[model samples]
Target: MKRPLVSAAVVATMLSSAVATQTYADDALVVSSKIDTEGSVLGQMILQRLSAAGLEVEDRLQLGGTSIVREALLNGEIDIYPEYTGNGAFFHDMTDSPVWHDAQQAYDTVKAKDAELGLEWLTPASANNTYAISVRGDVARENGLETLEDMASFINDGGDYKLAASTDFVESAFALPAFEAAYGFSLDDDDLLVLSGGNTAATMRAAAQQTSGVNSAMTYGTDGGLQALDLVVMTDTKGVQPVYQPAPVIRRAALDNHPEIAAALAPVFESLSLETLQRLNGDVAVNGLDPAKVAADYLATLED
Candidate 1:
């Protein structure tokens, strides 16, 4: 999800023309990004909230990856898009930096970088992108394994367990490399059951529900099944992965036109807890409900 960020030249035009039009009511700001089911639902929720606040959504372009969306932002093709904080680190080549510990640091770093490009990084939500190794609750309880460190020594001492991992896990700094370095153990090729082309949630569900060859799978900490199927996400005692708080990044000109946007959005997105996010994700990803309807219902609840 990498792309050429927007340049200052494009943002200058947007700012210069913003002050001239009283009839620009129909001149809706554009928002565009990738279309990952659960993740997209959250982004749509943000869009829905903004639209309800009388912001015209001239168009919504559900693209394939953040790469194109970022490029669009940089060239003034789009005004805003949902961005993850860790992505800022990766895109800015600060992947190994230790400054990004919380949402605040990530926001500040992205804002500083984007400022040079005439983009503004806004407040982040409570959701994160931490990785976890999930196992069925029954299997974990039976084997007395509660965390990655706990399972590591067991696997090291000749326990036969197949690990289901994404293809990216083989090389990603935040994926397999970090896990092995933190746990002091490694999985042999035979001990690994790799699933290519599918996402972590799909792998986790397959491992949890079906009789997959692998009993354990790599996943995110806030996956819906972690509770539904009574799965236990092994703890990372050694912090090896980077923080990934999801936040809205907008062009500076857009924020200037809608200064109240962040205050309105902050109250709604900031209070979202893990349980709430998982359940909301389940509504659309599992139950097949329309994301707009789900977002509408959830936003209504905030008023109560």
Candidate 2:
């Protein structure tokens, strides 16, 4: 069969497209995270796992806070990062919706919504790093307080209950007020010692030391200092706050280029239960271990 002549311009255009595609495929994946102990830990895990899978990864861990890292992902400056599923409420302006309070529902909602933006939400860790009220070990043991409901009854029964927390937790309607409304208990002005910043470390310390008569303090579910400081996180049985499960969110383009990324990370995240994450975070925050070392040590255990 006789072939028709092709224009030189068309041939050149085809070659250009091929080169562009190849360049994109060759580009290093940029991983980033928020500026926090958990972020650093999660980011390091992502970096190490992807590298182990034989993919070139650029480290941008501890990039910034939620806004900064999230924006970077959206802007294509970062290929992947750890994000909280519950934050989807604010991300999509559905904070009033009740879906964020459920773990699976929250993850499903965000995964579907972000799909429109060409993002992929991978499997989330079992841990829900949401706001929690932790009490001293002695107080919890003495009063048999394991959940927020128990604390509410304790407070109503004139039990000595003083909480050390950040001003934001005190004033935010979605925090202490939400707990009060859901659990049917209230904390008086005298019952709180409002700190300046929202660092749970300080709050946990105050409760551990009984500073200013604080037997309780505001904390997160995965805070490392909880166990070491002898503080017990009160379970949110009422599910007042959104479920903030950590998950790896990646740009669809990057994921398409490296489909193995999902499988490589699934087991790691699956192993991260609430207690496991607490222990990992403690290694860094309490033990002062390097985040990379902590992540490497944890990942090594999976091989065994």
Candidate 3:
């Protein structure tokens, strides 16, 4: 059988395309995360899981804060990283919207919105690491407080209520003020011990020690020290705070290049419930274990 004649230019173009495709496929994916304990843990999990799937990956974990990491992803400086579904409200300037309070709705909204920017939101963990108000275990039990509403009522009835929190949490309109408005209670200057930085560890510790009469602290739902420090997280019964479920957000091009990325990570994230994430974060933040080692140990449990 005779093959049709091909011109030299056509052959050269075909060869160039093949080389480009090959080079693209051979490129190493850069995985990064925010400089936080949970970020490092999630980043390590992604790096290890992708490597196990026989894909080339670069470790850029613990890169920086949310803004820095998010910008890197947008500018193609990073290929993938862990992010919260709730932050989409801020990213898209929809903080006033109520969708962020719902897990599936927030995920869907962000996933759909980011698609236009060539980003993909993978399956999120069931954990909601949102802004939380935690009280000392003894205080919670004594006051019969289980939720923010209960705390509000307690405070309205002249209960002792001092909160240790970061300046950002204390001042942010969307944070403390939103809670106050939703739950119908306010904290005066004497009612708060505002810290300098937004480290939940410091706040939780202060509350644990009753620093400046602070029996309560601003915390995230999945804070590691909650259980270890005997702090009980007051439930946000009215869904006042946005849901911050961690999930891997990737550049669409990277996923297209490696379709297996989604399947490789789905079960891993699916296993991370609120309690599971708190325990994992505690393993590092409380137990002083290495984040990489903690990720490795957890991943090992999922093996067949």
Candidate 4:
């Protein structure tokens, strides 16, 4: 079933009412976030679990980019949502230095910055959202190409491999340029197929489905399909990409009011290994299950 679209004015009204209700209820938190099929899978899970914990959840959601969510948090329109640490480093303008390798350092940097915005970043789930490169299982098995170091040798020795990458990968400071500089393998401009905006999942699935264009793609490290399509992630033997973990960020007022909220959701973080998260992502993103239900069921499993 589709959720009704709530206008900005309606959300504003709801926020006001929720704020007033908070005085009486004392456990209310307004979660504002994107409603896209991709983001909703993750957002709805957190929202649903938080609501089930007796927090009065006002889902005054919207379909927008991360910038919109960030602005909403700053304006006090929303109290909490899941956020990525690298997004804080790059998009939020914290530091130019690559700090993704150190999870604790990244958390500290983001926490310090969020304080300026009157926000607090809770402990992050154990998932790194770093950029990755993947090759078809067959190619990997046949050539023993399992890591970026292997791929660099293959490419340098004139291996017949092509790559499909997003425009972002082509331009991101941490994506392709870093790979080239670290490995000393320059792709013939013709060897790369640039997708206007699609990321790794689309390219990976397409590669699995067909043996045309490119044999590899640029992807996120924790993408669910890497194993599903029998694709092998070429290890960043040189360690180029940065770490990105998903975390809950809340308004300071909300945290102060309901200090136990983090503990309630802490179990979800405790069991979220890379493989576990990938299976969950496959269930919601690939198999098309309701994210809220998946999140709820997974949370329930934690109690078992």
Candidate 5:
């Protein structure tokens, strides 16, 4: 026999003394996310899509960081959340494997491994959103530097060059060193303006306005500030960084009961190209718009 449908009010009443309705620690298909802007927006998008699909949901948005949310899901406190494909390497200790650098291999490895723990990895979005290097539009246009290989040639020819980058990018295996290894170009300490502890925005802004003679900045492919700052993301043709594509992950038990969840999200994620996500992120990150509003606007576009 089917258990009677539980009303939101009744569920709220039960969990009120324990936790907020959004953070209800029950088996009602609770959806959750981390405390970052990307997490909030993507989690909200998943939550709203489930609700719109007529699936009863508990909106547990911004619950915590990746570890916290992963713990909640595994402990049966939440049913589903967004996760990156590349994270599985560390989560499962597969960093030594080459799968993380390849999209399909990473997806396959993660899905297969997580299934053993009763988690279902759903379809992922197309947007990679991984690390990239951006040069000022004029700099790229003048030198035809559209990809890492182009940058290599320009640097090899001793073209004027200076890069503003985060300290991590300077030392990380998948960053500058990898670029040099793949593209056959090298930049000594003299060529880099190491921000030490700076964020992408600072580096991007420096390059955008040509402050300090910085001609390039490190960025993510989906950074909202790219087009606005007239910067072009250099293509990672050699696949240096690990692919960080987003996917909806659900508890196998929850999926068994509400399979429609996958169908509803498939279309949404499919439509979310890298360009689309950047604009949506810009609304929240750069334009100071509310995350819910940005999600609503994008959903409206889908309906139209």
Candidate 6:
């Protein structure tokens, strides 16, 4: 057979055009979340939505902590993940700034800053997974401790109790020290049972079981174990910790291809509120259901 020779430039142009019309190696969006039940559910929600919208997706939910997932997105190993607004302050070394205290300010700062890194923040879920102080039901009832201020008053009056906290809580600027300074209470090393940072389930369990004379535990606002363990989560009435509302962040490259991604997810994220999140967390963290099932159920409800 005889064939006409094609120029190298013509071949290159044809290949490029094919990729533009169809897709290339990086076409399918890789979705991921942090190693927590809430992150898993949120990640599953996004993954499901993309699937529903007829976009090809790769699932890598619950990959690791904030840093690991953020790095993966930067390196293009993954295309998108869920992230908190307050974490932007820490990731960019702007923790001292007041932007983290206000939700809109925090979102604006992260969206603007991360844009430089080829990342895009989507509409954030209304739920804030900020750390909280939860106490045993009996302790909270007897002491009338519903807020950090009440805890402070009890502390001043010589209440005997200890706190279960992670090393991060003891050291992070947005944690114990911030609470102490905000509410005028102090927790000496004598008052804390510090464990290494990871899943907070263990720390919350310690308070639930009253281990090591501990009646207080550091918890996320949506921790399902709070009610199941007969623990009462104290209100952060003083706004000590930074707001941690989560937003779906995508690699700009992915968004460029699947521009409908943000529109597909906006309503779903908007429907997530604090109480709704707690209920969802309880379904997985307490009832022991699969995150995928929980996410699927929630998505079904969205249909009706």
lDDT (CA) per prediction: 0.71, 0.88, 0.88, 0.72, 0.82, 0.83
Backbone clashes for every candidate come to 1, 0, 0, 1, 0, 0
Best by TM-score: 5
* Model 2, backbone clash pairs (residues 3+ apart or across chains), number: 0
Model number with the top lDDT: 2
Prediction 1 global C-alpha lDDT: 0.71
Winner by lDDT between candidate 5 and candidate 4: 5
Decide which is better by lDDT, 2 or 5.
2
RMSD of each: 5.5, 11.0, 11.1, 5.5, 7.5, 10.6
TM-scores for the candidates: 0.79, 0.88, 0.84, 0.80, 0.89, 0.79
lDDT of 5: 0.82
Cα lDDT tens digits, model 5, 217-278, are 98887787777788888888888888888889999999999888888898888887877777
Off by over 4 Å in 4: 1-27, 36-38, 61-63, 142-145, 157-159, 171-173
The sequence of per-residue lDDT tens digits that candidate 6 reaches over residues 227-295 is 778777788876677788888999998899889999999999999987788888889989999999999
- Which one wins by TM-score: 3 or 4? 3
For residue 217, model 1's alpha carbon misses the true position, in angstroms, by 0.6
Q: Estimate, for each residue in 11-115, the C-alpha lDDT of model 1 and write its tens digit.
A: 455434532331233478776555655456666767887888888874454644565566667767677777777677756878668756455677788789889
lDDT measured at residue 26 in model 5 versus the true structure, 0 to 100: 53
Better of 1 and 3 by TM-score: 3
Off by over 4 Å in 5: 1-27
Better of 1 and 2 by lDDT: 2
| RMSD, candidate 2, Å | 11.0
